[model samples]
Target: MTATYQELRRSDLPSLRREIRAGHYAKHTAGLGPGFLQTNLAIMPEAFALDFMRFCQRNPKPCPLVGVSDTGNPMMVTLGADIDIRTDVPAYNIYENGKLTGSREDITDIWTDDLVAFALGCSFTFERALEEAGIPQWHIDHDTTVPMFRSNIETVPAGPFSGKTVVSLRFIAPERLDEVIAISRRFPLAHGAPLHWGDPEKIGITDLGAPEWGDPCEIEEDKIPVFWACGVTPQVAIERAGIPLCITHKPGHMLITDIAEDAEVPVRNPRAA
Candidate 1:
């Protein structure tokens, strides 16, 4: 007889982070961490932290600031106890002079004292509610990254930070569109509702099959495409700024936090490292 084990489809917050930090799970974090807040990560030197903070403030829809790690401190006390910014995210992309230079799984070797890390709210927070309401999420069902696009809709400029917005797409059934919108709107921290739906062209998205990030979605005939402001918007701003060194979570690979969307205190798992 052989032991049987099925792949993980649901997990508690601490176990997920422990898995990610240990360099075991590195896939897109779309369907994982259900009901907990998943965040987009941006790490840069102290020199650019202020401008980037203002940038996130001005562009709240796409770049809602949730927590900022103290300068030179690797422990993200505000978001979760013992969460290591350098290794907790599933994947990381490194940028130099506004260009993607490389990617790494654990940035421990490159971590430095001058770096400051910021966690921005991600739309995945509202997904549990959508699931509870019986709204279908195509990407989750397909086990693919949500299709993301860079739009012509300009962001409000803050200091050296400014760029067009990025949005993630989901095709909703005509009957579920209103409920999905209402539920999503309630989570102000999670990009807060759809920015544009129906016409990708209106937002300068020319092709539905081709996306700037994540996997391309196969749109069903009865489903309507709904666009939501995305946390990935900061990556574009970081690119344009061209700071000497910057790091961000790979699109769709988020920093799973111990904080539940509604919980005031961090959730802990005694076994998690």
Candidate 2:
């Protein structure tokens, strides 16, 4: 029988990590490991790591850094004791000369001493929080990956890292918006709260049925579309920067960390006054 989200949610962190490491689970990680943190992965040469780090620093909403690996080290000790940057993620996108070349279940062959890996907080963390708070996630209800789009909002540039922001969308009843925001605000590392909520066109998203990444979710007549800054923003920057080589976890496929969902993350208010 196929594993249900409930069953997966009850799974232990180490076992799930091992399954992902062994390439036994390569699908979207949205509802899995309910109490653990899930993160977006970015691996690139050390030469560009500083600029990318600065880029994340400048755009905290879209690229909040949760963990950074030591130069040439695959272990992300801060996130987990045995997390391997090269193989722990279910899948990875390989980019060459700023374009997607292919994807791999593991990148051990390309791992180099000059490489650096970064783990960015993903919305999955806050999504779990939302679920726990009784806020319905349309995508999860429909068994689809959350829809994401590239917004018109531009990110602050750092060296070779510059691009428009990317966001994930969820439909929520107007009455529940405040409650959802309150629950999500606690996770500063998880992109905080919604970036925009209402019409998709306002964010340069032309079609609600068409997303730049992930699956399109249903929007009920009584609900409004809500957008949250997505870690995929860095992938857009990498493409625009034309970096010679870059690797990121495939959209919706994330790196699961041992960090607890309720663990404290540095609080930086991303909301505008």
lDDT of each: 0.84, 0.86
Instruction: Please write out the lDDT profile of model 1 over residues 111-216, one tens digit for every residue.
Output: 9999999998898889878888888888888788999999999999887788999999988998888988998988887888899989789999999899899999
Question: In model 1, what is the error at residue 139, expressed in angstroms?
Answer: 1.0
TM-score of 2: 0.93
Error of 1 at 25 (Å): 0.6
TM-scores for the candidates:
0.93, 0.93
The stretch of ten residues in a row with the least summed lDDT in candidate 2 is 264-273
- Model 1: per-residue Cα lDDT at residue 243: 88
| Candidate 1: stretches off by over 4 Å | 1-6, 263-273
State the RMSD for candidate 1: 3.2
lDDT of 2 by residue, 222-259 (tens): 89888999999999999999988999999998988877
Prediction-by-prediction clash tally? 1, 0
